[model samples]
Target: MDTTQLKHLLGEMTRAEKIGQMVQLAGEFYKEEDSENTGPMHEMNMTPKKMTVSGSVLGISGAETLINIQKEHLAKSRLGIPLLFMADVVHGYRTIFPVPLAMASTWQPELVEESANVSATEAAVSGLHVTFAPMVDLVRDARWGRVMESTGEDPYLNQLYARAFVRGYQGQDLKNDPFSVAACVKHFAGYGAPVAGREYNTVELSERTLKEMYLPAYQAGISEGSKLVMTAFNSLEGVPATANKPLMRETLRKELGFEGVLISDWASVGELIPHGIAKDLKQAGELAIQAGVDIEMMTGGYLNYLNELIDEGKVSEELLNEAVWRILTLKNELGLFENPYRGANSELENNLVFSKEHREKARIVAEESIVLLKNEKQVLPLTHHQKVALIVPEDQSKDVLGPWSWKGEPSESVSVYEGLLNHISKEAIVVKTIDHSKNDRPKDWLDDVSTADVIVAALGESSYMSGEGASRSNIKLPAEQIQVIKELRTLNKPIVLILFNGRPLDLTDVVQDVDSILEAWFPGTEAGTAIGNILYGTKNPSGKLTMSFPRAVGQVPLYYNQDNTGRPLTAYNQEDKYLSRYLDVDNRPLFPFGYGLSYTQFSYSPMKVTLSKSEREQTDKIIVETTITNSGKVTGSEVVQLYIRDKVGQVVRPIKELKRFKKILLEPGEVATILFELNQQDLEYVHQDLSVSVESGEFDLMIGSNSEEVETTTVYLELKKNE
Candidate 1:
């Protein structure tokens, strides 16, 4: 329904009905722990479970329990205001696909989208209505534990992902789609740039970076018909996002024109007191309500004191109703109110949820997303005939998936040992040396590696290690993991480190200690076979680094595109006293943006630029053409990156900005012509006055595999510099 319909429907509602729309209760009463986990969770505190509430934030359970929990909600609440059920379906809910960072490394938008669809399918079958996913925060700092949740540091890439994940979750229509669910674009704004990449740390961003580099993905989600927009935990520019009218009303709703319901991050409303923004709980509720937040999650301030705030006139009834109207509209759009039992399809659950077809797609998505981080000497693609020693953590059989796989079964999962056994014969010797604990040490495996043809060291954080509040102060392999790898390397046996993680870690030593590294971010149920295929040389590894592998933790927000300072040190050739340079290390990042390796080598031909005003049909149009060839022995895929720079702009444009990129798969000795259309839009940059414009003088365009390696040409646009 439109706003008018929502408003009319809201006008007829009683105070309780209106309040119900704004309240989001925790999901504990109906979710049984089943003697599996014994934790102090509020969900387990409820005596007789209430079926219907504002929403259900499932407190960790599997498919059956999640569905039963929702069924109770629909069967109980007054007006049957069909409660919305939401879970952190970050990468994949049950099938446990790769974490966002690892998935981003793949650089395949379609595959990313497909993975989200699979996640939505799994959650929907379990009666979940929404997923707080596709954490589109632009992160430059790897130290931030939440990097696992984001797409990467670049805004443009996140924007592409924002639309892709939304399409994957909820397609053209949502009311009748079984695989679709409303994708709640999260952390609203500036949550990724936390100080020192610490959890819930304050962010201080310049206006230009926020708009150009951070906000595009959020806006993209809004345009893609996102039904809900979640507020972030951190404050933006001095205002807590839960109560910041400028961010919630003026910017998000007014300027960007998003009409969806505004939901707060967990406990962010009452959190205003800690941020020093609100005097008390009542004030927190009043400010957030007036600022246009429709649904409050966890913070009891709203459910308890909002009526008093309304009576005091601190929050207008109109403002409250507006929020209620938006919330109700979303519920209706979700088809919850029309048919309260809309999602409780027991028949569908019997057919779907981990079905063979769904599992097959999970395998494909998992396989493609496993990025080969390093494969020096072309040592990978191990033979089945060789004697193999698979030395992994004891949890390897269980945590083939890193995180968010409560509904996923490891029995259904293909482990490295099982996969190898399925593919190889008795002639091949496969040894397994697994000791789950890091403290006990795997010293016995050191001798095992020397006798083996190759060593596969599979290690990483147990899925629960680095997500949400799971941010770490130190981003490195566990001590025991480091020790095991160090010992294995002494054997001079080929070592492959299979990394299972939710985010990027400081793996500099691992990069050097092993022959190759495969980043299989919680590779779901099909991890075993997918990984086996890569090791046995069936699937060529095409994944690249989405976030950089920093040389050290001190290099927290390092990236390729940086600005030139007043006294920028000239490379290693120039001597400097105290310049904008690191005394201990080079200012350049360990790996530049768009850096990826392939099994086969690819060569970029010299670039050609045509500058006839008539040929381009516009004086500002600059077209660049380049040829790329697979110069090595095997088939592989490469991302052709295009960057542009204005020789002189009103403001200091980035040294170079990513303008375009294309993922092309090539067979051995294949050559293809790649053309990038250069328009004035491609040349746009944030100016001194805070507007995007194309400054005309000399614009240099370069095409290459990564940022540093470039083949270039120029087309000077001698037009009026945009104001």
Candidate 2:
């Protein structure tokens, strides 16, 4: 019956019709000429730009323009197979939500899911049919440029975010939906663990690490019903992930039971020539298709060479038919095949630039994603009555939104100053720092910083500095921005540093010097207001930092859950004796995992586990309860983290692994109970042979503000081997 609907529809398609399903050329790439435009991807493809791509990727998103382009492709193509429009609607579409990294910091699946839901509703209404999102890559090293785009360091959290994103994007029904664009969980296998955190770099990992840590998120995405997957540009075991049949076919499709399509990352199929695996474009096409890459994204790998590769017996016709069927089935599911341009609802388009509700929601997400990283001497939750000098040290126009905020507009975007102005009375002086783009810049925003009661200095990477291709070796603030902060400190006024960046930065100098610091990681269009709300007490800042900030770039790639070595430094004062310690600096990082500061202080009592191992043989339920109290004058939210330490193991394990975390908001002088009900499923980990099972052990339950600082309790559990 399923085949009947798709095959009968396919029977009517001509050669061009079928070919269109396989092609995915960049739709809105910049072109030199209008009449004969090939787009940016053509140069990478080594072909003329005028090629008729089957699917057009609107990497450049403008609702009206995207509709026009898709229409043109449908009209121009010989068989008239309507083009599927795709884009990197990564976080927020138009109304920017927090960056994916910042969202992960919340450790709240509900927020992440709702944010994705809003993204899908907005993007679909804006005329997009598919999104390359939820980029479910598990990143450990913060120095890697793309770290800002992933859920940090843990497979469990990444899985939670993946499932949330998939449900938000596709919803419960895929066979009939116009507003929800089909979710495409991307960079299929091990894209996050690039060597030295470089982009599109080689991945090297043991089979156990790969199975236990790296592969779970992809499995989660598949289980959540993600319809499409994109393979990574990097190679695993020296074979490109895009061309690794074992990973694509064996691990993903067959083992994980994913029946969806596997698309290639941008221009990656043709890149096999440089990878030295394929002789030419034709060979590249043969290898990728045979390896299970169903669609050639912007590379023409399947477009010009697939048929010939099939004729030569390098790729089976069965592969082509399977690929085509997967695509056509999705199209049918989207209701696109029956009504070619089903998503092109003019009413939705007409009313979809942005609305009051969208802006309001953006504000909420922005506020929710702002992580209070450090605040010494209890210096935050600024009052409206206080005369604050909001210094736009970096270009306010540029830094307020932080990089990769595609939806944010300068005037329309909420400015930190605007937020301040709205919260305060007429008496409050909201001074604007001069826009000085001089050849010789000043030390700070202005000389007289001492006069103000408080100061707000905005700093970090400009918008567009830390997403896909934005890799940075030295993760430090620009010299100019650093200078601004240093100069403001001369006045001895309590200063608050607002950092806007995609990835974590090494701010050892600023952290020690500034009174307070806010990590507002790319807070979208409503950034100013969200930040402003937190500063003037409209909203209590509840976000926790997802990635760890390093003291120096030398301590790069630092994360929690790293394996303890045999030579872990035990000597009180010794030189490098092959201990897991750095010689130049301390092995410890400036900040640790699960670290964040609040305006108010939080006290945690020792943890209590209600359920025991004796009753575990039945329905296993571990009810963990911890009391979190606000012991400060101001109100703030705290994220209580629970970590588990395997006291003894057949194999080596990390010092501490995050079991669960709860984000709770508390008023001043208030106490709340935090609880997590974990099942036996939660206790499972890959054995030496690489299958998940819970083994009996004496486990240490460590509760902490961050990974390094912990108050722990011990618990004994009994389970048979292969448990």
User: Highest lDDT, which number?
Assistant: 2
Native-referenced Cα lDDT, model 2: 0.76
C-alpha lDDT (0 to 100) for residue 522 of candidate 2: 77
Query: Which pairs of residues clash in candidate 1, taking residues 3 or more apart in a chain or in different chains?
Result: 28-43, 51-72, 51-73, 52-73, 402-463, 402-522, 414-528
Model 2, span 514-632: residue lDDT tens? 98889888787788788888887677777766666777788777777877777777556466567777777767777666777766688988888876444445435678888989998
List candidate 1 segments past 4 Å from native.
1-8, 30-80, 425-445, 569-578, 612-618, 719-723
Quantify all predictions' global Cα lDDT against the true fold. Answer: 0.75, 0.76
List pairs with backbone clashes in candidate 2. 38-49, 402-463, 403-463, 403-464, 404-464, 694-723
CA shift of 268, model 2, Å: 0.7
Compared with the true structure, what per-residue lDDT tens digits does model 1 show for residues 59-129?
A: 44344565565566656655455667777787776566766777787788888898888888777766778
Off by over 4 Å in 2: 12-16, 29-53, 60-80, 425-446, 570-578, 613-619, 633-635
Question: Which 10-residue span in candidate 2 carries the lowest summed lDDT?
Answer: 30-39
C-alpha RMSD by candidate, in order: 3.5, 3.1
TM-score of 1: 0.92
